[model samples]
Target: MKDNPLIKTLFAGSQPPHLIDPLALFLLVLIPIGALPLSPSEEIHLFLARTSLLIYLGLRSIQGLIWTGRRNRSDGWVTSISWSSSLFLGIGWGFLSLSWSLSPFTSRSVFLDFFLYISVYGLMTQASLPGKTVKTLYQFLVMMALLVSLDGLSQKFYRYDAYLPYLTEHPEKFDPHTLEIMKNWITTFRRISAHFLLPSHLAGYLILIIPLNVALIQLTPTLWKRVSWLLVLGVNLLVLFFTESYGAWLSLLVVFAFVLLYPLVPRLRRLGRATLQEDSPGQTPGRLLKTIPGIILLSAGTFIVLTLIGYSRGTYLWDLNAPDHPGYLRFLNWKSAFLILRDYPWTGTGLGTFKIAYPPYMLPNSTEANFAHNSYLQIGSELGLPGLLMVCLAAITWFLKGLTTLSTLSDPEDRIIYRSLFAAGLGFCLHNFVDYDVYIPALGLTGFMLLGLGGSGNAEEGEPGRREEPSPLRPSPASPFFNIAWPACLLGLSLWLFILNGKLYLVNIHINQVKKEMEQGEFEKAYQIAQKALFYDPGNPSLQEISGVLLLQLKQPERAARAFQKAIELDPKVPRFHAYLGETYLLRGDLAGAYVETKKAVELFPLRTSYQKRLEEISSLLEKYAVKNRKP
Candidate 1:
């Protein structure tokens, strides 16, 4: 075995192989840093985190196309191809969804966010997972977890958080609604968000990172490293408890149980025994390095742990569908999402348009929400069932392929690390049942990175670091069809970013300006800004709605009516747009038009007291008109 270079470096305590890759180390570091501010789900625009990810992705794309040799063999095609293809279908479908999106402005922005992050997922799978890179990456996860936990503690005790302090200093940088949310988080809410925007989001991040700490504590090569990981894991758990996120608490218990106990199954035992036969000379016996590293009474152990924590401070167990229950609102959101799916089952309300489209379908007594609180339902409502199917398929492929890779690994340490990453990802997936983390760049990207690392596209002999003979010093041998196809994919992706995404960003800037002007009571200025925005994105329902509002404010009733009608054409599901159009009709003295449009608004959102009152007023006016006509 000409002793593996990585093995040599591990024992020798020499410099790790920098030649293998220094870029992935930078990427690994960037991810934890980026997750902080990018934690919230975007509404009509994107977070600045998108820029950093684009740069990271652009570097990786350059490396793939120019520096690294393209994969020529079918070594890990089952994992790589299947995962990428399914995700591609999901992304492609999301792109197509813009045509039917209820709010194309938001949809396009969200689609770009997903496209970039998922692209990170695909590229990361191909990243070479050598020993030093893997170890360093795990360290980064632990170190950042501890720091974020401390940040949460600060919010609890000192009433200050690292991620939100700057917002107070410069309120103008953020929108008024955003500032209100931040203020509410600090003053109105007791639970800590830390680097995230909500306690649930913080809990979601912990669920994604803590399992790796479990793996690290057991499977780390050194005693000091193991102790540190254990400490970090405890800190993260403490923060998770403080978050009072019941869903994450439950998800952690179940996923940890599965990871720790499931390996004791007879099949896994057989696999462990099989790996024992191939232990390396420097390594301990496989029996000494049991698959779970000795946490076998998982289900009972978790229960005792939960009891000791008092089931996590203020967190109650799963609730009945009561109005006051914490989860009741989520249940309402889910039911409404189901209705949205029923209405737009094929193309969906459009990718990332759930918050825009979901209002009309919300169950009675339900308030407006940004998410379905269920990733699967959100995906279904936003991207349609087929899109959901593709996402599910990608997850299935990652898990199964990762397990297959795990079973084949000859090295005990490699197996442990893989098992740990798998659990981290699995826990987050389970958490999504109650809290939708995948839409948030931080939580979603972290989970995907772990999943990607678990199934390396280059791993062949169950070894992430296993070396293969180098390809000849030339471009990868590909069929004529593939040679052109690969380049075409690149070209299309570039154009999609440059043309469509560029225009989206432009429109977003204008919309932001419009909002600022409107908030300042500068309706004329806002209307002018909106008009300019429409020149760029005439199809965006949001811009049209704002324009209608501005027109109404300017006392231009007929023009406002036209703008509202256009908004209805763009997104008929939004009841307020219809109501505004009805108001325009009322201003114009078209009693018939006012009655018809107001009736439609009331029909769409019967729970709206304002809409109902408006409808009543319209009916009264119509009656008056009829009586006057009869007298004449």
Candidate 2:
């Protein structure tokens, strides 16, 4: 406790205050916990992590963000990290676009994820990064990835469901359908989703982790560490192979080629050396291969070899089949995303609103795709052009800065460490061209952390094994008030977000409790718990829909109509909300309203046979009412 940074800084006579390292570890644990009990909706915020972060922010908000304990006026890389401002601005657009979000609740929930990621990046960049600290973080993440990979391998060789026997035996779970869906997703024939929602998400995690592990193998001097990392990488690559993700395979090849080009092409290496850590990942094969013609031939040959390997293994990298092919679905989603951007050019549909806004634009026979499959296009369609531009600029900046950081490292080990981060981040960026890691917290959090570590661990000349002082790239205000203002804003924002996050988490808990009670024939109890849940997250449409069902069961048609009406407002894209509202209208003897509402439900989701039949029933009822009116 005495050795703790926060402990030393506080309650000591002369020492200046410093923030603690707990925040750092929380950010690191994000990769693994991202997959577990958190699941899909619980991502509102990791309750414990967020609470601790809020406390940290509350303490720092008044003092300042960057600590001066190191250099006694030290500036950190938070704002100065090449493209961070643009990244923040892009996320800023995501926050502001909430006003127009197709589903305000979804936008509100997802924006926190982006906020948490950027905050993690900011917090990481501000802290001092010792080599041991870097190595430990790398090791922990590698082990976690290794476990996930091994689990995936086990699934491939042994069973279909990821942990069906372990997870499926619970009869008390509110929604058994969710478990069935999870089983279906994890059981992608001979492929491993690795407990991720989809195989592609596991592929996303793999591509990012493998390069970093390769970097580790190069950096570690000890044979044991090298062998350990190599084993991890080998397993990771094998899992990647099992995933059979065309984007992961092709993107990795592109990155490997880029790494190769760094050594082969002197002009290119020298060109980016001005402000980045410019270095190659692996050793050159031979001097003969460095010449222009030789390099071109080697590059082409390598590219062809990798491409052919994937093609021969049934990669389907460019399947032109218009239907039933993954690539074609991706193409259709991209096309649909463009149409979304065409209409909502200013702000698009809003952050996390893509799924809500996308259905109306889904192409015929496309099976109702959610994500755009391209992170950039989705960002454009969801957050608008400025948001897209900012994110792109930030990415380009991180890559360039990574190059600069690489060039400055005198030690081969240090250079390799930075290179691995650079390669992993670049690979993820390129991978996003055909997939959406943006929605996956595990991938996005890891990506941002890697991006922050881009220029970390730099040492000043002649100071071996010491952390470098951050170069001040912008003006720092010495005023106490200015410092207090920013931190206060962070504190205030965090406080509000923390409250909302708590609400969301509690709502998830209570709603599940409600469903369990309902399953056990406790309608009154379920209704009571549902109201409690809605009090926390009134914007949740599913909760509202459930409440309507409960109200109808309780024989309160007016209240049921109002509940379904609220659900429709919260999520107009859902067919059932409109259908339920139509049911309430019919109970009230409003035949015309019932017909119109049911018709809209069928129109919104023509694929739902149940909705179509309901619409037909409403139409027949309306016709009978019309015939009776004519007779009167």
Best by lDDT, which number? Answer: 2
Give lDDT per model, in order. Answer: 0.68, 0.69
Q: Candidate 2 local accuracy as lDDT?
A: 0.69
Model 2 ranges with Cα > 4 A deviation: 1-45, 65-84, 158-188, 270-315, 455-481, 571-575, 587-589, 602-613
Cα-based lDDT at residue 77, candidate 1: 18
Candidate 1 Cα errors over 4 Å, as ranges:
1-20, 28-32, 38-48, 52-84, 100-103, 160-189, 219-229, 267-315, 318-322, 326-328, 342-346, 457-460, 465-470, 473-478, 498-510
What TM-score should be assigned to candidate 2? Answer: 0.83
- TM-scores of the candidates are 0.79, 0.83
The local lDDT score (0 to 100) that residue 614 gets in candidate 1 is: 81
Model 2 scores worst on lDDT over the 10 consecutive residues at 1-10
lDDT of 1 by residue, 324-374 (tens): 455777788899889988888888888887877765676876765778999
Write model 2 residue lDDT over 419-470, tens digit each, in one string: 7777887888898999988677778777766666563434233111233432
CA lDDT for candidate 1 = 0.68
- Residue 363 alpha-carbon offset, candidate 2, angstroms: 1.0
What is the clash count of model 1? 0
